[model samples]
Target chain A: MNLPDRHISLAHGNGGRLMRELIELLFAKHLKNPTLDVQADAVTLPLERHGELLFTTDGFTVQPLEFPGGNIGSLSVHGTTNDLAVSGAIPKYLSLNAFIEEGFEVAALERIIISIAQAAKAIDVAVVAGDTKVVRRGEGGGVYLATTGIGIKTTEINLSMSQIQPGDRLLVSGPVGDHGIAVMLAREQFGLRGDLMSDAASVLPFTQALLDLPGLRFMRDPTRGGLATVAHELCRGTGLRVNLDQSAIPLRDPVVSVCDMLGYDPLYLACEGRVVAVIAADQADQALQRWQALPGGELARIIGETESNDPFVVLHTELGGSRILDELEDDPLPRIC
Target chain B: MNLPDRHISLAHGNGGRLMRELIELLFAKHLKNPTLDVQADAVTLPLERHGELLFTTDGFTVQPLEFPGGNIGSLSVHGTTNDLAVSGAIPKYLSLNAFIEEGFEVAALERIIISIAQAAKAIDVAVVAGDTKVVRRGEGGGVYLATTGIGIKTTEINLSMSQIQPGDRLLVSGPVGDHGIAVMLAREQFGLRGDLMSDAASVLPFTQALLDLPGLRFMRDPTRGGLATVAHELCRGTGLRVNLDQSAIPLRDPVVSVCDMLGYDPLYLACEGRVVAVIAADQADQALQRWQALPGGELARIIGETESNDPFVVLHTELGGSRILDELEDDPLPRIC
Candidate 1:
């Protein structure tokens, strides 16, 4: 029997002939890999010796589904990959689950699947397993993608908040808030229009550059809550104070202008492809230089320093005044990924 | 700051202070384990020596969110766990990603989370990492769960269709169509109301019982599209034919009644806690006896045998006549999980 032509139907998820056709024609056709077996309910892999395993999961509910620099498909891969990369792991395999609405167009689903395939290929990660489910039209969003990533930690590098010292230096990789602004522009909200693109690329290379740094204490990808929220989390239960030099931080002109027009602070806006690293103060300059030489880290800068006294994040404004950058209380925008 | 008392909002997924509070109060409070660290983006685990790693993913979109015997939370855990169990692995860790609607009630979320914790605890599996995303009210079903399970294949027991041969016996753990019937009854779509409950539970014990059996060739948890679909898959490309005895397959009275009333085939409906196993014909009785002694395997029986002549599933009716059990063409029910 021929599969449905235009829109996805419940039969595609029924685990029968049509579902088998969908998997073969759409998923396997694009995301083919040696480890992916449609007949097997689970994929088996040989464990890498002398390596610790890292596991991470994320859900992509970004509005518009497709955005300026990337779509939800690529974001799903990058989100999980970045999580493992920041934790000092080499991403290897991924499991994807797509919850598609009944009325969603099959062509769009194919495009997203292709993007997912391309993103995984670029990072040398395999889409080893996947599941699909269809909800009634109004009951589901366009498509919510959830990805689980498994990586192997090959290095002895340990990055955690517990190892952070008072003299640690906080560095920001490239500009902030590009992804949030890009999503907002894609929604056409606030009558906003620009050529701005999201910084939604993978941070694997950026993270790798600092992986060997002896003084690296902790690293994180500032995705949903941006750089400031990451800072707040780093010092929340600890007696560490993060003092940020706002003027030294890098920001794209369009992102800065967008933040100015709206009441949103770029520091708190999302960045799908940026990393916040805490390194020793003595090695901060060398780390910044190494990052600047990389492709996505030309604008890397040491923007803050940790103190032993207060437990709050203090931002020194361009006007020489200081204020506490408290944790975000409300949702500035939703589905920004 | 206090978390919202009533319903979930976009703020709860913003990765800000509210999201943190939600995680700490609801998810962390219930699903907390040594591997579930709030501060880490990914969890690190030590690898099991001499064991192959198994990975599986599944999305649960069960309607009504809560059903007679299990809710989506428990279903999510059972679905992924069963997939691994049937693959000859012991489930170790799970990564959960929740896509919640804006107006979903907090009380319901808490209940579901508690159920997830309970289900994981029953099997000694850990929810090592998780993610939460909230979509707008209309864009999301109340809550959709996606889970990825990691398991360790400790033994050399390989179970796959490639190992199946002619004259192999097919055995089922228990009654069929209970999950589908239970969900359909919960929907009240057909004015159906009874004490029918979903057979949604962990199949680890059942799968474990037969792990060391030398006659076991393959095992599968008949889920969506059920026994018929699994039979179709087992013989599709193998030039093998499956012959099933309709009278011998165990069926709950209510499930049989519902299928008869609705003109639905019980073999085509879903089953959550059932396993279809292929064992050597000579050892079929031994496997059946072993399974029948288990708690959920009271009705275990050898209901079918595979042949090498044809590639279709031939069903012998109660009248002693045979017919083809074709693959499901359209969905009789959606979001049945």
Candidate 2:
């Protein structure tokens, strides 16, 4: 049957054959991770040795449900896990809620559910408690998924605003704006893709690797508002200026070219797999070496440093002047993920 | 400026003066509740003595955010709490996520947030964490909210389908179909109302009250697809037949009348707050009395009893006919939240 009729019908939410099929066919193929196969009521998980727990919840309502790099299911898992990882927590269990449009394809529903299962498995998490509801046509676009995750804090991973001090080094894992640019490429609004690929990967292992090191003080995944916003949040509370060397940051040629074509700033565009980090000056090189050891983070670099000044994020340009990094004014590409 | 102007715009989601105003003026007014007055980043709450934790999450995307007796905010709090309560948990902490269309009214938003806070207060819970994002105008409806709650479980309370037994008497807390009928009236489809109001109260206390009665075998809040679907779930593993007396179940006059006009069954319609219990025959009268003592459960009744001979749900109709209760098939007034 033809899909994207632009509204959700009642049948989309039925939890029988249609719902099961929708979850299996459309969303699961890409998410073939193992933790998702248990099919339990709730995932009872193991925490770190004597770590305090941290839990975070997030909901996805992106239009189109399916995007260039991922769909809502995978995105929900990544988004919730990222929240915990960034907060220095080892994400272990997840709870989910799905709101389906009426008359949605059973195939599509199966795809989403399986995709969620796969994503959970990929990150060593389980889809524990869940609730599903159906909304009639015109009530919703397609499907919306909300995820809540509980994590245990790793003792050595003390990433906090209070940890920042003068002379701290900043770094990012891999390229930025790939996810946003790839989504725009999928839309084909202006045919702006130099064969871009969406950079959507679960960063739990990569985060755990950094936390294993002795000198790191901060870590965050640049997703929704991107690097500019993340940089601002880091600098806002410490009253320490962040002097970033723009030339040192990693970017793919296609991503930069597409941003030029779309009149968008790559700094504010989203990146799903990238991590922004702040490390002590003495340990910066070792941290960079550790990041470069990972497949996705092979191009990790020292992009900035903390300095004595008003809380500001300054980007040094090739033009021999410095430009201040500002908080993102609006989403560069709405529903890019 | 005029708000909820027939269409949600991009400006509504911008977290500027306009967004704050929309929340303060329109939404807060209708959602008028006391806990919302302080308007902090997170609400603080205290649990009852001996109260344990209960948790549940829900995403409400009903086609029309506004219905007869409640809106998404009211549904978010009550619905999540209902799921947690019936599981024998005392819900205490909540995390919420809101996705809004750009140009949604500042007034309407404030009203929704406040209403949510008020609802949580009424139920003696707190909203601990929240996130909000704005989607471009046409990409999203006015708003969608996801809430996750954490509550304590009492010392000795557990409700599950495995607790069911043969010869147990079935009891209902109050009238069925009021919520479903009220929402239908809100849609103004077949001109229905008067004898209906959304059964959208918090059912935590109601569920908790029955637990102290040692004879209470199983309890469930029948929401989507109503009491029939839940009963089917209860009877899944066990070959126990539930014989419900149709004449004994309470239904509002409006609900019965509307059901007749539309050829809908009251058992299939959704109920937000009412509950169903299976108690030993010896404790059925006391259970009914306990339910009747609570305002939310005043119309309590002994609707049926279980028999080992028949494993399905059979309704003993007012006309002395027997009919099996099948799972709800079509969308019974879809989005009648």
Candidate 3:
């Protein structure tokens, strides 16, 4: 069946002929897989052996539809899968939900769908089930995606914030705030432009390398509220003081320049493809070496450490001055992920 | 932390203090379960045994957010779980994604969250994971929800549209079009009002009773595009003619009256909580008896049958005349689901 319209219409979501054609010619064609059956309401997934299952979900509404390094499609896939990866699980299957606006360009939708398929294939995960809905033109952003991921835990590594203890060290996989600055530049809302690309890729390699380390207490991808927000969560979760050496943290020049010019703090910006890991001080160097050797982890750093029980985050500046980093209050960026 | 504002702000989704408070005071407070941890990046789900896993997803963007019988929250739960139910699986876990518009009322959001928790509790399904995003006011319909369900196929009954034979009988668990008419009435679009309620309940009881039946060929919940759409799918899928006896198909009085007044067809309307099943001709009576004994299935009937290899749907009217029911074209109601 051919989709005769160049732009989506309300009829495309009415669950009728148009909807079927949209699914057949666009979504189904691009995301074709053995597990995806348009005729079946539910798809069956084969589990070789189920010991433990990891489930996570995330919603994406990044503006511009297309960003420098990734669009909402690829970002949605990575956002959900990264959550599972950081939790020490082998990402397996994902279900997608797309809420599109009427009058959206069909060609752009196809591109986004193709990106989704590619990103899922990159991680060897299947887009097993999906749904699409079109809202009235003004009632939705150009496109919004939500993905729910199912992963299997193949190892005995159990990571959680509750496992963090005083004297633990914190390491970041790579530079921070690239995704936030890149997306901001794509928006062009501030009369600024740059060639910076979003750091929006699956963090599976970083997490997998450290899954075998017994000292790895927890791992989380610094996303919406960025590195400082993650530190706040750790302090609140473990009631321990988090001390960060600001000079040790990695940051790209473009991101730092953007932040400096816009009065934005890079530490509170989002990063899609970075990991903040809490590890025992004894194994911190080993963890840092492993990440630094990976493709995207050349700038990986042992950025901080946990101190006595005070439940606060402290940033030690390069000039030998220390200041408490308050929990994020106002939103500097919205719809970032 | 107390929410001082009555309406949602962009910061509530920015992964900051307000977002954390919103989750803790609203979502976490209402949908508290042992498996749900707001601080965790991903949650671990325990599987007692290995078996076939059923996965399905659905997006909900019903207008008026709150309708007659139920709101979008409960409807989302029923919508995704019903897909699993009709597939002959026992729904085990669900992951929810909410996209909220800025300036939406906090109290109303709480109400919807409470409803979601209630609906999940009613079915013994755990909401294991969730994510929330807030968009600018004009970029979203107050609240759009997407739910992905995971189920375990405990029964040996394998049902599919391909299993439907030419002589199979079609049974409807109850009346059609109540949800569509009820929502339309709630909208008061045409200066009309009615006390009719939506038939938006889970079809688990109906599907469960017939799962063991040897003659149960296929089962589907008539949702958006309603029973006629399901009939159309049956014909197109199996290359068989669908003959519906309009006189035997059950519909409520208010729904019929609304359709008659509005030039609408009940068969094309949506039904949130009803089942359309295909059974062997010889076992049609047995299936009807089983459904009729259930509380909500009192109006069950053998409404149609499959015949020949023409791939079309024909409605046999009460006056002994028949007309072809064409595939749905324009959307009568855009956000009914």
Candidate 4:
């Protein structure tokens, strides 16, 4: 912890004394575990012989490194792990890559690293390996994190878009657009401010609770393109029409108000900690009940269903009409994740 | 292949139609393999149950993205895989993360992706998972890459600094400082030019060749901080004095000239493709012969040896005088790897 500089410099990434000190004092100190060896080129992982291995990766470049409920550090961990979670796996190990800009505050870096450690510890996942690189000033965002997660799939059920049928129902674990709006408001670009926190927590519990159900077809965390994008994916993958009821979907008051004020579609906004699951029509109610029993799934609802052979995402209106939800083109928010 | 824009935009990382097209046409097309599933949130990997699993990660931020012998794309693959290689493991899978700046050339991106594919294919490794993010122009280097490699340790031999003893001999696979000087000259900051290509390549062949040698105590690729820094690491780790013979160390003419002109120490320069190994004195000549028989190991030499209990890296000058080689402080070359 004998860091001599308050701000990072190019030497910190030079693989020299400074780089070693930064990694040892900051990164390794925060993410210390039995599996992590700063001196070794690689660490060995212990795995069971029977289960299928799962691998997933994600990159986080959210603006305003610190957001309402989570920062890029915590979000990076949740994001990659959730990918494995929705795929019916238990995340066990993560490898982190940090791209830090020269001149960034060392204290801020420590805070983010601490956040990453806390989030990873919460889920019992260890950051077994990591690398740090420093980009020259103006050549990087304050910090960008990329995490690759390794997991083990113990479930007998195979969940995939190919498993979806025409009559399969769609259920959401919670409200959508909370993460997107929370980040936007944090930016204060439109002079908007709110106490809304991002719902950027792990979706492991929600995905695990329904794994025992034979009716579960597929599950995906609605991330960058949100609920409607997941709907579009289902349509494209299954070659079916997606019918979403606007009145049935759950939306928070603040998220709805912000979307209304900014002329953005809540359905297409990103949600970090939500799950849109495809379930057999007969078991949709049971899935909803199970999700609702979870802490973050109070607003769990059956919002949509797949039908017909056409590949279109249709949102049913309250006025007894429906409109097509086009695929995302222009980015409404850049670096949202 | 039907990309409309000549340059990348923010939408390409927004997890939308554009992102899908870019991934499908560029990344997924080139990196296609049986284990890679672009549509799946997480891909399943087939791993043997008996072998120890090795995990390693590295981040690449080399400026002028492309150099004489390689680009950041190829370097990223080699860098991460090399870590596993020196750890006495056979690299199997890799997960790539790219942080690209908006307004970058699409064609250049394609070339880099192709290089990545080619390099991975050369080593018979697969890029099973990946993620991409776009930073606003001026907020990032052209592109930064992070790769996490997963390999299985089939060899029962354990290589570590803890296994080192007095009288251990040191051998380098090839000439040093080529990669550092090559990248530096590529920048044209020193107004120097050369036909020297980077030594950036996988050290799998070198390390694999010596894994069967029971006399081999430890091996490391002389990367960012080069051979001298590695020697310092040996001294610090084992509390042993390292005696390096300057004349015996291999150094290419162009690298030596560049270092003399730039007033930089060749010992501290990076070598992306070289290996500095510690072997028992009784078997040092055997290890050297094995390395010299390889394609890029013509200059392989026994450069140094460990002796006594004092923790100092001493350079034995050709004049019979010795000087202590200090641990690297200032970074002469940043992002050489």
Candidate 5:
């Protein structure tokens, strides 16, 4: 059976004939698996006897949903998976809940579904359970997606902010602000264009590599408020001072140019796929060398280190002056995912 | 620290200082537990040695956000918990994600959070992880919540539509249409008022009681499209005919009057807290008696029986006539759940 060749109606969320058809034809067709095919209220997951489970949830509401590098569909998967990855867990399954506007196009929905399926497949994760709801046309954006990810921690690694100590070196996986810049240019409100794409991809490989390193203290993805915000949180949580060498932080040319033109700091812009980690100061050099050898970590750098007992982020600029990096106060961007 | 005393701005979702304050002062303050207090990328849950895990997710966008008996906050918990309950699993943890409109009131949000915590506590579940996003004022309803629940099956029961047989009897927990009617009246569009309260609560106790019964084949909460739609799904899945006795169905007087006035079929309206189970015909009476003796199942009824190979629902009306129960074709009521 074919779906209505038009926009989605409230009937599509009625949980009856049309809803079942939409699920079977669209969702199931793209994300087919034994667990999902059961169509039960809940999917039964078979787990090995003893490891701990990782749980994460995120809501994606990126405007102009389809962007240069990825769309909201791919962003949702990457966002949740990255959370699990940074926490030393192997992402396994996800539950997707979609809030669609009543008149959203079926074609657009199908494209997003296909993208989600591909993303999940690439990361070896299963879409085990899902739910959909429709709101009146103006009551919702085109679509908003919330995802819950479940992962398994197989290794005996312990990562926590409390482990961050004085002299611990900080390293970032790649360049900062690519995702924020890409999405901003796609909006076209600034009359700027760029070929830059978001660094949005699974960081499982990079995180896994660091798991074997005994010097690793903690790791986090620099997402919503970017690297500076992450540094601020690490300082706040551990009651330590983070001194960052701003010149050492890597940035793409376009990102640098846009930040200069728009009076934005690259450190405050969001990154869809990047990680910030603390490694024992003595092993910092080895960690950087190893990371640089990896594809996604080619631009990795040792940008900063922790200092004793001061709960603030201090930026050491190239001009021989230092400034305290304060927390964000204004809502500079909306729906940046 | 205190949350900003104003409408939620985009800064609240910026993953910076304001965002942390909002979460710590509001959500975490109310739903706080050891696991959630960790504030890690993901909470690592320790499960017992061996058992199949159950995963379910649902999005709640009920209009007016609050109604007589419960609000969207409590409804969100009940909705996801009930899904797990019907699967014969013990509800454990939930991941909550909320999308709030830019100008939504802080007080209303606090009220909602308090309700959620109470609901979760009553059901012996933990709010282990959560995420929040704020959309532009008009891009969302006041607030929409999506919850993912993880449960464990401790019993050896395996329930599926495939287990439904020709002689299986259908039993409903209690009266229908209370939730849908209550929400409709709360909207005041119909110019009707009543003391009607939604039957939105956890069905854990009810489902837990039936887990020990061997005659129980399958169970589902007749939510979104109601009992009639559920019957249709069972018939379509198993290629069986369901002959339902309309006279045996239970209804509250206010619900019946409202349905009559609006020309709405009570059979097609939603029930937030109810169950429809398929039991062996010979054991149906015992199941009914046991359910009727419970707190919320005072009006439990054996409403129908399954017949082989017909693949449709036949309604034997109180007027002594039979008619085909067609699948839901349109949106009878939106946001009922």
Candidate 6:
């Protein structure tokens, strides 16, 4: 073993010799940024002297760590950023906690770290701290990630749902269901694909751009149960009716066809690189154009509006009628983003 | 349907009607908080204008959610808080992400949520956001909790290993291995118990007590792989050696005897609610006294010193011999959180 090994075995995460060797060699070698090398029991980060620090934590258990359009490494970055972004803060630092299965390839681990580093750099955030542990075989499903983000909030922004108004219009940036379908196709679990790409980009910018807009009540990334679920949430939380224009909702032909084939509704599918906005009626058009200007938000459009009557989500049909959109019975797509 | 369920069944964790009904009537009924009502794709929170928010997240998967000192619910809170506390932050908020097995029981779920609420109340941390999902019957073990906490960090405190020197003193806040051993005893798989109770309590006060002490370099709870990993870690990182007086290392007699019986070292075992501190050699005496005055830190002791030799952790054994302390060989105390 004079030459360093290039993979993480069960022992690497077992808190034993291999674990030490792995950290001393692989992770510590590339992760040699200033903070981690301090080797403290816990990190003492460089704190901001002025405003309040915003903090958030998230855990990821998406079955396959590597997926189409993205992997767990990139997802971890986006996941943490999204949390801070929705909290009305600018994510500046992150603490990553990884639980890995034994026998994960060292090459693969390096790839992941490189991916994480690249993603972190892309988002302009730093991986300031981390902890890694290995679970025994048959006990873990390859890998799981738990990341905590630290952000600094300025005095200017306050994004809260309690501030939502009665007549605010709802807008969604870009076409939906791409991310859900992309992962599904990547799994090849369904043996389906057709120009469907995972919309797994970060929403930090889109939301950041709209922060200064006048009367921006609330903004959300339609993940998990997607637009329909979030739309239902608006009505339920604010006791307002939301009437969605079916034609106004952007969708790719491939996503629609796939949804039709699978008996899944595109409206209810997850969208990672999308934004759901609840803005003042007057600024709705401006928000749409602003979103369109961003790389990830080309298909921006006005999807719906909040109303006093009905007090439920009602979708205006392409056939000129309306139908009540109930809360999603179940997630049509799982492990998306 | 009429007979009360004795064990967890598949319908409880399913995201179907049964799952919704169980959450609404059982878990939600007990853990009711304005923020817990979130069903949105992402929760929207209002941050205070002045306070820095600290956030941390952890995934709870300790074999049995219902354990000796606490269940998964409470453990989730404690585990997350410990992570946040070790960072020298004041824990203020938490996000609970639950992955429940399809057949989980409503009654068990209720017990878990109540424990969570109690844990939150005990720490004065609010459960501000959460996500719940149900897996298929065989997809999950029982219930896994991923709790994320947020806390505000004070700007003045600077705790890092770079502060350690050759003459720094080592301290342990309380007896070690109690929590790890207690969990194993509860499993009864090894048919062992020895008056060992869990050291599972909030250590925030103890941590806060030591933050600003002039002698402090860094502190950490000797959890997971316990004191040895951290002791070895201090030396390994800063190129300094740590020599611990075994006679001074506090351990309950029962814990000592049990580790002896199991062919393990108490130094390598886990401590749920203890802190290991590095203090200036001159101030070690007063630091020990302060720790001993606290309920959680009552068993605190000055057990070691930083050195340039034995980059490995060296113990001055009771029998006048020494051993090169290494990392955990295997998970000696599994599910011992």
DockQ for every model, please. 0.88, 0.29, 0.91, 0.90, 0.88, 0.28
Please give, for residues A210-299, the per-residue lDDT of candidate 2 as tens digits: 786666777878876677767876776577898988898888998877777668888877787778888889988888888899888888
Task: Please state the error at residue B167 of candidate 6 in Å.
Answer: 3.9
lDDT of 5 by residue, B95-152 (tens): 9999989888888899999999999999989999999998988999999999999999
Candidates 3 and 6 compared by DockQ, better number: 3
- Give the Cα RMSD of candidate 6: 3.8
A245-318 per-residue lDDT for model 4 (tens digits): 99999999999998998899988889999999999999999999989999988999999899985799999999
Q: Report clashes for each candidate as comma-separated counts.
A: 0, 50, 0, 0, 0, 9
Off by over 4 Å in 6: A1-10, A20-38, A44-57, A86-88, A162-167, B1-59, B83-89, B133-141, B148-156, B296-298, B308-310
What's the i-RMS of each model? 0.9, 4.7, 0.7, 0.8, 0.9, 4.5
- What is the lDDT of every predicted structure here? 0.90, 0.70, 0.92, 0.92, 0.90, 0.72
Model 2, runs deviating above 4 Å: A1-9, A14-50, A155-157, A212-215, B1-55, B136-141, B193-195
- Give the candidate number with the greatest lDDT: 3
Model 4 regions more than 4 Å off: A1-5, B1-5
Model 6 clash pairs are A7-A106, B9-B103, B10-B102, B10-B103, B54-B150, B54-B151, B55-B150, B56-B149, B57-B148
- Fraction of native Cα-Cα interface contacts (under 8 Å, chains A and B) also present in model 4: 0.93
Reference-based TM-score, model 6: 0.87
> Regarding TM-score, does 1 or 2 come out ahead?
1
For candidate 5, the TM-score is: 0.98
**Candidate 6 positional error at A103, Å:** 4.1
Off by over 4 Å in 5: A1-4, B1-5
Worst 10 residues of 4 chain B by lDDT: B1-10
Q: Which of candidates 2 and 4 is the stronger one according to TM-score? A: 4
